[model samples]
Target: ETLMEWQEQRQKPHVAIFPGFGSGHHIPLLQLAKQLTVYHGFSVIFFTAKWMGASPHQTPPSSSGGMIRFIELPDVQIEGDHAGMSFLVRIPLLLEKANILVEDALTSFP
Candidate 1:
């Protein structure tokens, strides 16, 4: 970025937060997200994989507060595996897709 663009961006920093697919990860991650928005002046987007939840019936929660947003992908399926195992196998694919999403989102900035 040019110096002018960089200076303007600091006025509205953007952070993309994608924690691991378990609560042991998401809990602390959420806290960090809160701090980044509340203290650091960053706008953050939190991504959760489609299958991640305490129970299958539970829906992914949403945050409407300014500077924070949440998005969830559709669940992945791998043939001939138990549900738990499939989650681990699907992580890499999801990460790749998320990276693409991030790059696309960045292009809209500036």
Candidate 2:
């Protein structure tokens, strides 16, 4: 390819986005991801839960010409008494369990 194209590709800033559990959380972040790639010329890595809890909007739009990528963190199992707990109270535990996978994904990201 051309030098300009190579330089532009190399210069694009990379952004890693991990939205919260439900659709309410995912939609806004997904919008931001789209804007970053489409308008700001950024490369984005969007992370989502493999098994979305109660959100109907599971499938987000596809990547923007390879500038944005979607990666699913493997299903996180919530054990113990969390079933009776509210979302706010249980989210920390959920995220803690998912942290390792997130780190791995970021480390191996190209």
Candidate 3:
């Protein structure tokens, strides 16, 4: 392995990061993404709820100096007819949807 190989590897370390449902959850994740991209030369894809403002702050590698990106989540709704376990039970379902979104984003990465 040569220095060029190592540098190329550095340029290609991709990561996808998502935070849970609040600003408290968001800041820490964003800080870590910042460190990973700024200090370690990582390509980061950061996920935020659509309500959390993903598109405005997306910093994809092609778009800026910082290789951190933000992908927005779609609004999730539970079917009213199937509301047995209450909204709490629907949380995981929403996360499942988010996981699918993440998987799709990953597959689309080049």
Q: Name the top TM-score candidate.
A: 2
Q: Which residue window of length 10 is worst by lDDT in model 1?
A: 55-64
Backbone clash total for model 2 is 0
Question: lDDT per residue, candidate 2, 25-101, as tens digits?
Answer: 78888888888888888988888775554332365556566676778788788888776899787778778888888
* lDDT of prediction 3: 0.70
TM-score of candidate 2 relative to the true fold = 0.74
The TM-score measured for candidate 3 stands at 0.70
Superposed model 2: Cα runs more than 4 Å off: 1-10, 54-63, 78-88
Error of 1 at 22 (Å): 1.0
Task: Tell me the spans in candidate 3 whose CA falls farther than 4 Å from its real position.
Answer: 1-10, 51-64, 80-85
lDDT of 1 by residue, 54-88 (tens): 32114323442455666655555445545556655
Best by lDDT: 2
Give candidates' CA RMSD values in order: 6.5, 3.9, 5.6
TM-scores of the candidates in the order shown? 0.57, 0.74, 0.70
Q: What is the C-alpha lDDT of each candidate?
A: 0.63, 0.76, 0.70
Q: Which pairs in model 1 have colliding backbones?
A: none
